[model samples]
Target chain A: MTPLDCVEGKGLACVRGGRTVFRDVGFRLARGEALVVEGPNGSGKTSLLRLVAGLLPAASGTLWVSGGDIVIEEREERGKLIGWLGHHDAVKPQLTAAELLRFFARLQGTRAQSVTAALERVGLSCAADLPCQYLSAGQKKRLALARLKLCGRPLWLLDEPLAALDADGKSLLLTMMREHLATGGLALVATHDPIDLEAARLQLA
Target chain B: MSAFAALLARDIRLAARAGGSAMLALGFFAAVVTLLPLGIGSEARLLASIAAGVLWIAAVLANLLTLDRLFQADYEDGSLDLFALSPLSLEGIAGAKIMAHWLTTGLPLTILSPLLAVLLHLPAAAYPALLVSLLTGTPAISAIGAVATALTVTVRRGGLLLPLIVLPLLTPVVIFGAGTVLASIDGLQNGGIWFLAAFAGVTLPLSPFVAAAALRLNLSE
Candidate 1:
């Protein structure tokens, strides 16, 4: 463990609609660390990821990022620090993969150089020019993966990060996760399957 | 590009290429205007009398045609999540979408309304009035509709509810918009235009924030 935590949550209580998904949940992660969140269906894996990403208002608790509480930080600045990958791949059916990545890259204020490299990293260079609707299930996942790398954010909140992937795609995700951790980034991933990585585990159920 | 400009430009391009908010709204507007004469048995004097009100109603309905889909596609494709989590505030995002909606749907409707007014026997003197009224009024449609859009963001089939919630709120705009042209035709002075401008002013500054707040509420739902 480092002397300081990258993300420190204390007594996070999450409620989706009328149901309380989790209560008094807390965890601390350091830079260059990946915390793998494991939970079965309806166990609040997705809810937890959202709460940390600042997408959902916690019923009660404080989530601190980079030693500063997220609530105190302006939403835009807090948003700039975290990258979220949800289940629904945000692939626009009408837009070509390159165009979508370029748009998100510009939206994220990421360098243009990262767009091409990110596409290539996800093995999407061949399919970058194709409209998103034409890409297969795996390719769409790759496109979402490219979006995560397109930003220069230090924190990643990924829900079910390995849902639809072939062996090669799975390996690509692993490589990307490794690279992100090596650069002192924090990735909090929600996954149902076991993956090879030296990551601290957070079990929801 | 900055997030604000990038979102605005991307949405406009998307509307032009794929979503076709322009074609749908304009086509609906034209069809409604075109059918008025046929349905009413081609009474020239009657058409002239009802021209401003009929065309104004058409404009409102036409604008409503595309309002449901404003946030539907983005919400479906998970882009809303990205937008919510981005460095862009929800208000900023809603503002960009309103701008884009005005460009593709409202601005075109404004430009075309004058021509349609002529088809409805609008007086030549009222052309400037119709044009200016539509130009000023449609932004109000977009601004108020942004709130409707955000509120309906989570509804699966928002078609019916979209108009139901919005039509009542926009009653004053429709009334004032038609009043502007009608006032011009009557050669009388009324504060119709000032009312429309004031309505737009209120809607433009306030609706985005209301829409953004609503979208946040829907986020957890």
Candidate 2:
């Protein structure tokens, strides 16, 4: 793990719908680290992750990710460096689980073989040929995580990663995340659920 | 496959599925063209004279039927958010979808126009002109409709607003498209086809940028 691998945001402020969502949010995480953001409802936990993912523009502060071979400064271009898991599963009902993963894998420019591996990793291999509309909600969350894994980005911006996850799914995700951190990847997770990970915590009220 | 091709293939597959709206557009186009003669009376000469215009109008409206969902479906499903995060530029994503819209709606409508024109007793001499004009002009319709769809994508129940914004912009396409067939019927050499082609030429290339800009606004907000 390169010590240079990390994400840093300083005095980050976000405005949405003509109102400030959050302000002066700052954090720095070096390689093999995770930051858990805890907050009440409407406290902008999701907004903070979105801000870092470059999906939302910072109204007041500077946000940048430094690590890997190249540094990303542009907000829009930072998506190339992030694997985002928002509240929405982003699954199409018409597509089978395997097809869904393959599509995302292709979009991520990952190898074709990774689709099968990701499905297996998420315990979705048996249902891989089944259409997503038939999959349960927790299964869908697993599918999203599999997509997150397929992205292979060094930084993960996961929003509510624990939502709708069964116990097995939860452990599976934690293990995958731990593996990610072990491999020099960092994560900023936004969640209400308390997780068991040796990580930094940031609270928003 | 590249992201553009992956998105394009998925969209086309969805449209081909049952209740995908692609067939709905084609069926609506056929029904409108078929029922028009019954409403306007069975005067063959009159039908022939207006066939180009009426079919063009039906084709335009039919192309519009499926447009509202172009970006709305992706946005609602949150695929669009992920797409924005992907390596593909928003402009490239917009372009691929515009092409998909053309493939499913515009291209199919073009193919079906002549069959419906037969019901209107359109002069066989103008058939090639009708095909060529639609081949050139309907792409502009798809392109322009894509931008309109993207602009209204964030609005709940935006389908009702789509035609109001799109149809007015399509006046020239309908005019030049129908005019090309009309001119062909009269054996006159007019610039109608070239104008139609030029309109498509301009809008097809420009819609991606305009739609991408709209998408950027909608996505960030």
Candidate 3:
């Protein structure tokens, strides 16, 4: 795994449905940093994160990630650096929670042990055998968190992550993010609520 | 397991679970083949004459029954976005999905065709040809459906349009598949099976790239 140290973008712009969502956006986020993206609905907060995650191609400009002497700009290479948590939890209703995590663990090339560990860390050990359809919204969000943690990527792109999370679940997520940052990982979280972390802020208008 | 294997296993497991698409397609295939003869009034020669065409059409329709949601479910549940971010390439994703679809739909339909053929009084001599033709031809159905499904994945209620887009493209597979079976019954020296195999061969390798391109376009939107 490449130890990603910094994510840099220059003159980034996004267009969807023939309308410009954001233009000339630029930022540099080093390891151990978090950038909370603040914006109103329809302001392209999700699009910006998606762009950085290599899910959405930027309408204009270049974005790259670097670790020491390794500078990466290709979309596939950049994708390897990101762990995404979108609004949808990405769970199949028929598969049990454990089964779901196991599949993602394999996809991400994470060890089998991480699946069990991540489930426990996310406090879903008991619900591991339950199909995702039976999981509550909070439980499902936590499952997504478990998957995010399992991927072991250096960068995270989270959109509305705190939605459907309980007070404890929210705190669990915050702690997970804190641990992720403390371990030289980077995060770009899009949220309307204030996050209790020492981090940079990017406000999208 | 590799990402491709994991995805294939997950999809197959999902299809084995309750409300799975595989069972739906299989049931639909069996139901239509069973009901059509009742409507057509099974005079032996008439039934045998049309059996190849009818079963081939039923299998195609059965295969189409599940195609619209093949990628849409993953796309809707955010799995597609995560899939995009994963180590697997989009082409690999498309291929894995196509394989899972075939295992669940095409292969099963092939297995069930003989049993359904009895209902239509399919000539005993044509059984092997029916099996061979379907086995070779249905992968192309899955392959082409993947491209069409990927193209329409983001359109709400795209299922209504899937057949319109896919059935026309599948005509060659149907014609060639049924032609091979019919020729075998008539003991004709025709090369329809070769043509059917050739169509599948071309489609199997090419659809993944096309589907991947369509998926990339849709995901970026």
Which candidate tops DockQ? 3
**Candidate 1: where are CA atoms >4 Å away?**
A1-5, A67-72
Write model 2 residue lDDT over A1-205, tens digit each, in one string: 2234768889988888988888898999888899999999999999898788877778988866776566777665678778889889999998899988888888867776888889999999999999899999999999999999987887888999999999999999999999999998889999999998889999987
lDDT of 1 by residue, B98-180 (tens): 99999998899888887888788888778888888889999999899889988988889987898889999999999999998
After TM-score superposition, the amount by which residue A164's alpha carbon in candidate 3 deviates from its true location, in angstroms, is 0.5
Question: Which residue pairs collide, candidate 1?
Answer: none
Model 3 lDDT at residue B79: 94
Using lDDT as the measure, name the better of candidate 1 and candidate 2: 2
Arranged by lDDT, best first = 3, 2, 1
> Interface RMSD of candidate 2?
1.2
lDDT of 3 by residue, B1-221 (tens): 39999999998998878899999999999999889878989798999999999999999999989998999999999999888888899999999999999999999999999999998999899999999999999999999999999999999998999999999999999989999999999777489999989999999999999999999999988
Q: Predicted chain A of model 3: TM-score relative to the true chain A?
A: 0.97
TM-score of 2: 0.96
The prediction achieving the highest lDDT against the true structure is 3
Report the number of backbone clashes for model 2: 0
Clashing pairs in 3: none
Worst 10 residues of 1 chain B by lDDT: B12-21
